[model samples]
Target: MDPEALNPVIDKAVESGIPVVMFDADAPNSKAYAFLGTNNYYAGVTAADKMAELLNEAGGEVGVVTHPNQLNHKERTEGFRETIEKEYPKMTVVDVKDGRGDQMISKEVSEELMREYPNIKGIFASEANGGVGVGKAVIDQQKKGGDIHIISFDTDKGTLDMINDGIISATMAQGTWKMGYWSLQFLFHLQHDIAGELEGETNLPRYVDTGITVVTKDNVNEYYPGE
Candidate 1:
């Protein structure tokens, strides 16, 4: 969706005394009350660190699969790339390709990437579908749980399963429940003028870092539902 298109709607909602908060994806230019979601850039940095560790600091070529134009994905990709370049000098980003947030497309693109850059040692998947797709590509190529490591985003069931099977090395898990709960709290505060109770502060924080965790085989069982 066009960020510009959202500006008018967000402005109208604010003008009508309705509170708006964006999560997962953001429109920084919008007049929403706040953004409550993962610190996508930092999550990307986390992925970089995990990927480096999985490669045992002996860095090699890595590829990225992500939504190319979305704001959150863009930030994540940027963070991963920048961190790799600055801190892991031995690692290089061989290519970045759009996954379109679809499993099949991601798999196809990942397969192409693997074929093109056979020396690629790792891949950072910026979303769940992309992560699973990358895993499938690796498996199809008979490289699953082998030299190519994968660091992915989110803890969807498929991603977790892949991690369990050693097809994916790790994943960045977001605080999804916190995003929902805090978004409501912020909206309630705005609607009820709760901030007026504060001595000096009258505005909610513009951005909230919902936080992220690296999920790996050692703790993968903990992330399962009800575990």
Candidate 2:
């Protein structure tokens, strides 16, 4: 997600009086009417806490694989990195790799990260493919036994498979359905003023936090919506 490219478009849409609502990922610099999605930074904080638990509170070096260009991914990684540094005295984010949200690329980066940080206790993959790729890299290098804890994002099938197979420890599940459902509602509200006029405009929150669910092996099946 190139904010440089997308921001201009969003600004144009707003100028043309088209109410633009951003979902999941946002172009923050643009005049987007509102954003409806998870509070990604807090979600990252959640992942870090989970990782701390997985490492038995004896934190160590951690690596990150993420797409830094996107707003949401950046927020997730920042949240995770900051929490590790501020809350966990023993842990540090030693390195970061640009996974670009590609499975193969992420896998390659994960393998490289492990080689560089052999004693890396935790890895936070801030995207779904990156998580699956990190899980595969861990399994391939024989590092899955809680020695290298992993916290990944999203509830995709690949991430779920990683959790079920004990390759990935846990992942953040975004309220995707709510993001979609509310984005439309926000758009409609922008045009129709459904919430009723306040002052000179309709009343609507600029940001709507759909929230996240941490999915682990114990609750993976129950959270998976389908059998």
Candidate 3:
């Protein structure tokens, strides 16, 4: 949806004295009270560090698969590229392709990327669908268990399965539960004017870092329900 379409909705809500807290994806131009979700940039940094470890610091070209136009994905891609340049001189981000947050499209793009850069040693997928798609491409090309490493974001069932199957090396697990909990809490406080009770404070933090964790083979099972 066009982001501009949300401007009036947000304005209407705020005009009606309703508090809006964005999570996962943000509309910065809107009058939302706050954005509560993972620090996407740091999540990318974490993916870079994990990729470096998986690559044993030897370094090789890496590609990024993500939603290029989305704010959160852009930040993640930027963070990953910046960290690679700053901390891992040998690692280079060779390409960035828009996955459109779809499995089939990401798979197609990953196939093209692999063909274009056979020397590509790693890939960072900034979202779950892209992660699963990249893993599928790797598996189809018989690159699984090979030198190519994949680091992705989120712990969706498919991504977790890929990690367990040794297709994806690791993934950054966002604090989705916390995002929901805190978003509601913030809205409640705003509805009740809870912050007004405090001395001179009338608003919640404009942004919150929900958090992230690197999910790898060693602890992948722990992330599942009733595990």
Number of the top candidate by TM-score?
Answer: 1
For model 2, which pairs clash?
none
Across residues 68-132, which tens digit of lDDT does each residue of candidate 1 receive? 88878988999999999999999999999999999999999999899899888999999999999
The residue-by-residue lDDT of candidate 2 on 1-227, one tens digit each, is 76557888888988898888889877777888778889989999999899899988887899999998787788898999999889998988999899988888998998898888888887899989999888878888774443577899988888998899888999999999999999998888787757576785547887889999989999899766575
**Residue 210 accuracy (lDDT) in model 1:** 92
Off by over 4 Å in 3: 1-4, 143-146, 197-201
| Candidate 1 lDDT | 0.89
lDDT of 2 at 157: 87
Go through the candidates in order and give each one's C-alpha lDDT. Answer: 0.89, 0.86, 0.89
Compare candidates 1 and 2 on TM-score and give the better one.
Answer: 1
lDDT of 3 by residue, 24-90 (tens): 7777788888889899899999999999999999999999999888878989999999999999999
Ranking according to TM-score, highest score first: 1, 3, 2
RMSD of 1: 2.1
Q: Flag clash pairs in model 3.
A: none
- Scored by lDDT, model 3 comes in at 0.89
Q: Which is the better candidate, 1 or 3, if ranked by TM-score?
A: 1
